[model samples]
Target: QQQVKQSPQSLIVQKGGISIINCAYENTAFDYFPWYQQFPGKGPALLIAIRPDVSEKKEGRFTISFNKSAKQFSLHIMDSQPGDSATYFCAATKGYSGAGSYQLTFGKGTKLSVIP
Candidate 1:
């Protein structure tokens, strides 16, 4: 079974609307949650991340909402725009700094399209 699950394989949002993507993890050891945004022909780039201790984190138009008890998290795009059209991925991992090593388990991914 997949460690992380994401819903709505795809999404369509109108310009200036809000786009939401959700994910759930089965592993309680996952302490770090990160969301990645990928444009076609490019590797996924880290967009934002949150620790289990944080309830929510927002940076500019992007935000991440986390629920520790539920072992779930979601990404919210504020004022969605055509430029925001891309594939979004939610990932979880137990970050370890001792050896400077970490591994990530990613959700299948959500494709978001902002229609003008």
Candidate 2:
């Protein structure tokens, strides 16, 4: 089963506009929510993250708002730019297990395009 689900397989935004992506998960054990941004020929880099303890987190132009009760989270990109065009992924982790390992479940991914 897909633990994490993302919407809008693709998105298009005008320069300086806001770009939003949403995701949902079914596992209540998930405690960590992270968003990753990836460009062509590059690995996914952590953009921002939030724990169930917090409702939101912001870093520069990027922000992550989480709703623990709804099991949902979203990424908001303020002043979207062409350089921000890439694939964004939402992920969830339950933290370390007794075996000394953790598993992360990622959404299908959303491809974002910012036009000039």
Candidate 3:
């Protein structure tokens, strides 16, 4: 089952414009939300994140707004540039499992392209 769904599988944005990607999840047990950014031939790195208790979190030009009741979250990139072009994945953690490991679920991913 695809617990997490992301919209706009791909996006094209102009330089200095804002890029927005949205994601929704079906599992309420998820407590931690993290967004990862990946470039070509590179591993995905943590971008920004928010917990269920917080509605929003921001770092630099990247921001994450979360809605606990709606089970949705979003990533907003301000002043998008060509360097920001890559694949972004929104993920959620379901705390610790019986196996003593955390269960993480990721969205399909969104491809972003920024043109000057």
Q: For residue 57, what is the lDDT in candidate 2? A: 93
Ranking by lDDT: 1, 2, 3
Once fitted onto the true fold, the runs of candidate 1 whose alpha carbons sit more than 4 angstroms away are: 96-101
Name model 2 segments beyond 4 Å from true.
Answer: 96-100
For residue 36, model 1's alpha carbon misses the true position, in angstroms, by: 0.6
TM-score quality measure for candidate 1: 0.95
Model 2 lowest lDDT segment of ten: 95-104
TM-score for predicted model 2 compared with the true structure = 0.94
Q: Write the per-residue lDDT of candidate 2 for residues 1-116, one digit (tens) a residue.
A: 89999998999999999999999999998888889999999999988989889898999999999998899999999999999999999999988333324677899999999999
Kindly indicate the candidate among 2 and 3 with the higher lDDT.
Answer: 2
Candidate 3: tens digits of C-alpha lDDT, residues 21-101:
999999888878889999999999999888888899999999999988888999999999999999999998876333325
Candidate lDDT scores, in order, read 0.93, 0.92, 0.91
Weakest 10 consecutive residues of candidate 3 by summed lDDT: 95-104
RMSD of each: 1.4, 1.6, 1.9
